[model samples]
Target: MPNHQLLNNMTHHDVKIITDYSTDYGDNISTVMTFPTEFGDIQKEYPIFFRKYPDSEEFQAVVMLGLFQNDNLFLQAGNWQANYIPGAITRGPFAIGFQDQSADGGSEKAPVVHIDMDHPRVNTEKGHPVFLEHGGNSPYLEHISNIFTHMMDGIEVGKTMFAAFKQFDLIEPIELEVTLEGDQVHKLHGNYTVSQTKLNELSAENLQALHRAGFLEAAYLVRSSLSNIQKLVNWQNQKMQQQVTSA
Candidate 1:
């Protein structure tokens, strides 16, 4: 059975540190998040997978972005070349994913997050737009609006942007404006603070922003892993066919 610790940890805290390994991915928790059944007797395991990049060397630095459309979640994650443009924003990737659970878990329920897919530029350079390169499948257009497609499509060439959660330097604990929407709307979720003291702290005001950015990157990584695994499965089948034919 797949471990649920990581997912459990993710659910408990809005932000947590994670390390990825090819063979043994390390997450702080040991349980995955689960949803109760209608009978309230069983829980379903949520699927979790990491993104695989065409260039293995760039996986660590790159992020994956995703969006949901027609009940299927679409995703693409990548970064720009070092020499692409002048004064480019050294930003994290964009990612898209979906969660059915909501605060109320009833009518008027919405996904946990509402992606700003229509934004002209997010985390990237001022004029840059997010997009996937020519490959396996075209990205789902539901999350992003048509108004910005032209600008985004142009920047998407050779660049795949994923969602990200940015790391920040924290000096002191701060009050973060957390948007809590599911079951209850709490203007202030909790005391905003980071216990990691070894690092020089960023201003408290920037903590929430960093957390949001970092989350985006994390989502991208997850999406990339899923696609990478799918590709690997396909490659294996093809290789097996070729060998059989030769024999």
Candidate 2:
């Protein structure tokens, strides 16, 4: 239900985008789509996991933000508590679109920036402006462009990493059960993570290939991020205690 259009200074000269993090702006989510290229930074604050794409059978990496759907623990009083927000989450209301381009007597598609006019972040009078008064790209828009470029590159690297993971059977399903305050139980299922055992058993030639492709470090980053799951549990407990005290 998004009203997407090619971003142009002429048409959206006065538009501003909300850069603040809050649930009101749709930041309340349990996970955000992530990529292998970002696994190193993402692992520092979030637990990395894989889930099947809803429309496709392919697996995609995600940075878990909360234990339950629609619950983002990092959103505290309209601010993001983490040092690094996932690039996927930071690029709000903007996406890379392909447009036809004439080249060498033939037409090909080129990536372009598209903005969702209907998104909550889109406003005419508040937050960061997308264009300057002179109808040029604003500094915020330039930052978004860089983010989109990195996202595109990350997508390609992620494809290669996931393909290698599938080929080596290094993915394994994980089920997490947590007992919260008042003995409330929460269960998460159907998620996947890197299998260190399988990774260690890979042939030397395959290991070398992974190392050459830079997936070896990415695999370990994914493995290391699982430790943050306990951090998430601790956060939940603290939130629950605060709720009880306030009540």
Q: Give the per-residue lDDT digits (tens) of candidate 1, residues 90-199.
A: 11112223455545657443222222333223223333223334321113222233323322342342123222222342212233232222333223211222234422
Point to the candidate with the largest TM-score: 2
Tens digit of per-residue lDDT, candidate 2, span 44-79: 999999999889979989899999889999988668
- Candidate 2 has its poorest 10 consecutive residues by lDDT at 32-41
Best by lDDT: 2
Q: Give per-residue lDDT, candidate 1, residue 8.
A: 20
Give model 1's clash tally: 47
CA error at residue 88 for candidate 1, angstroms: 26
Candidate-wise lDDT, in order: 0.26, 0.91
Q: Supply the global lDDT for candidate 2.
A: 0.91
